[model samples]
Target: MINRILVVCTGNICRSPTAAHLLREALLGCDIAIGSAGLGALIGQPIDGAALATLECHGHRPQLHRARQLTAELAQEADLILTMEQGQVQGVIQRIPEVRGKIFLLGKWQGELEIPDPYRQGPEAFEHSYGLIERAVASWAGRLLLRR
Candidate 1:
């Protein structure tokens, strides 16, 4: 019955967007709508170039997306919210207590750690981060699908 999902990261320019793309592709059978946002967001920016390249390598062609501020309304609307780090989960919950149960780390379910922001780090960092996003999203989607 989960009909909408929101992925979160620091800037929304890299990690979250990549995770959204992977989830959309892998969970194609689901009725859920997937999206991403940032906590300390650079609102209205497109996905980073290196992130685009990394997704392309993975056979994912993501559509246009602009970063948006995290709001209580948004958090309340989503059926689930996935964040890159523990701090973001706390931030979202503090702002919108209703999202408590649905909030989780994109990394933890995949048996790893946080997906660090690679902004300004260089292509190598973007590549590494994208790999982490892909793996986490795939793992999450698989578990979600099974539950359905």
Candidate 2:
């Protein structure tokens, strides 16, 4: 019944966008729609170059993604809201109390791991973030696909 998912991070340029792209690829052939947003986004900005490179290096094609701030409307539309860190769960819920039950850590199933922000850190940080995002996306995809 969960048809739409929103991935969130501190900024949309790095972690969230990367996860959204990977999740979209992993969930191919399924009916779900995936999107990414940031709690403190630099709206209208493109995905960080390093993040894009990391995703491409991992065999996933990066989209022409632009940063968007997390909005109440988006939160209302998403059946599930996955955040990169625990603090984000609080941030989203504080903004949209109706979504309390639906919001969760992106790595909740992966032992509640928190995906770190890799913006401006360098390619290595981006690479590490990508690896974690890939694993989290794969885990969520497997479970979501089973529901179909």
Candidate 3:
């Protein structure tokens, strides 16, 4: 029943987009629609350089990704909304209370791990965040694919 998924973070340039791309690949051809947005997005901006480099290092071509702000309509359209941290879960609820039931931590299966932001940081920080996002995406992919 998870046909639509939205990944969320503070800025769309990093964690959320990374998770979305990885999830899209993990759930390839599964009829799921994956997207990402940010609570305070640098709207229309490209992914952060460090984050982009990290993704490219993993063979993912996310060059076309652009940052987008989270909106009520987007949240409403998603069947599942995954956030990078617990605060983000509450943030989504504060903006769109109706989405409360569908919002959850992206690392729900990894002991509720919270993926950190690597914006303005060095490659090491971006690499660490990417690692966490990868693990969370793998865990969610299994559960989501099973629902389809």
Candidate 4:
């Protein structure tokens, strides 16, 4: 049973938070916990407006998503750490080696694609990023929610 999972990205304001919401909704009946963080977060800021709006369109609005910094302590506690890209996963692995097998790109195991950061990009970029995360998290939930 995967008790906890952490979704990570360059900033918690966008990708990770969106991924966390989808996974949480998909695995609502399970006992697992889902969370997200940023490698270079601006702690306490709300998610960027466009990204939040996109997620809202998908029926998810995270209530209290204060940006969180990536810490070894948090990484060590997670059962699985899913990132948006392989490079980001590598960064986490270097910082918290204990998270080894558990640290992986959210799109890696399945699509082998990278969810590009839509930070400074326009709505189209955010929309594309949202699609990537939604599919990956949905697949993750399916596997994680299986009854043991």
Candidate 5:
């Protein structure tokens, strides 16, 4: 059974954290641990304001989220690793080949959709990204619930 999940993107401040929080909510009360990191993280940074606002608008109270860089140790710890984009999958596997079997696109169930980054792109971009992430998270949650 998958117990640990890691959501990943280029920067932790946007896509990854958003997905992670949504996933955490979706998997609430389950024996699953969800977290996020970035390939090129803005370490110590908080979630992008627009992303935060979008999440709040959607009723997800994301806690004190701080950006973190993806590390081999973190990758190895996750039973499943979800990436926002295809390139991120390659980037993670290329850096940590041992995790190749566990890494997948966050949108794997949504026609292999990729969640785009909305950094500095304003509210519309963040909203669009949030919608995609929400759908992807729902898809994964259903599959994961079945596994449980």
Candidate 6:
């Protein structure tokens, strides 16, 4: 019954978008909708160039991803919300208290490791973060696909 997933991070440009697209690719042909947002987004801005490059390296086609701010409405719409960091889970819950049980760390299934933000850091940082996101997505995708 998990129809929609929302990935969250500090800025929509980096971790969240990368995770979102990867999740979408992982769940290919499934009836689930995936999206991402930021707690304090550079609204309407395109995904970070480093992030786009990292995704391309991993075989995911880059898209014109525009940053969007996280809102209560988006939280309400998502069947499950995944955040790049533990702190982000609290941020989302604070904004939408009703989404308590539905929000989780993207790495929850992998020992709860937090995916670091690579915004403006450099290619190395982006690459490191991308590795973490990839693993997290794989873990979640496995569980999701099994239930379907």
Once superposed on the true structure, which residue ranges of model 4 sit more than 4 Å away at CA? none
Off by over 4 Å in 3: none
Q: Give the number of the best model, judged by lDDT.
A: 5
Give a tens-digit lDDT track for model 5, residues 1-148.
Answer: 9999999998799999999999999999997999999999999999988899999998878989999999999999999999989999999989999999999999999999988889989899999999999999999999999999
Query: Cα RMSD (Å) per model?
Result: 1.3, 0.8, 0.8, 1.2, 0.6, 0.8
Write candidate 3's Cα lDDT for 1-148 as tens digits.
8889999999899899899999999999998999999999999999888888999999999748889999999999999999999999999999999999999999999999898888898999999999999999999998877777
Give the per-residue lDDT of model 1 (tens digit) for 1-148.
7889999888888899889988999899888899888888889999988888888877778999898888887888898899998999998888888889999899977664788888888888988988888888778888889878
Q: Report the Cα lDDT for candidate 4.
A: 0.86
What residue pairs are clashing in model 3? none
Query: Compared with the true structure, what per-residue lDDT tens digits does model 4 show for residues 14-54?
Result: 99988888888888778778888999987998888888999
Stretches > 4 Å off in candidate 6: none
- The per-candidate count of clashes, in order, stands at 0, 0, 0, 0, 0, 0
Better of 5 and 6 by lDDT: 5
Tens-digit lDDT track of model 6 for 34-85: 9999999999999988899888887889567999999999999999999988
Model 5, which residues run further than 4 Å from truth?
A: none
Error of 3 at 31 (Å): 1.4
Candidate that would win on TM-score? 5
True-structure RMSD for candidate 2: 0.8
Tell me the lDDT of model 2 at 84: 92
lDDT of 2 by residue, 1-148 (tens): 9999999998899999888988888888787899999999989999998888887787777779999999999999999999999999999989999999999888989999998888889888888888888899899989998888
Residue 87 C-alpha lDDT in model 5: 96
* Error at 129, model 2, angstroms: 0.8
- TM-scores of all predicted structures: 0.94, 0.97, 0.97, 0.94, 0.98, 0.97
Q: Global lDDT for candidate 3?
A: 0.92
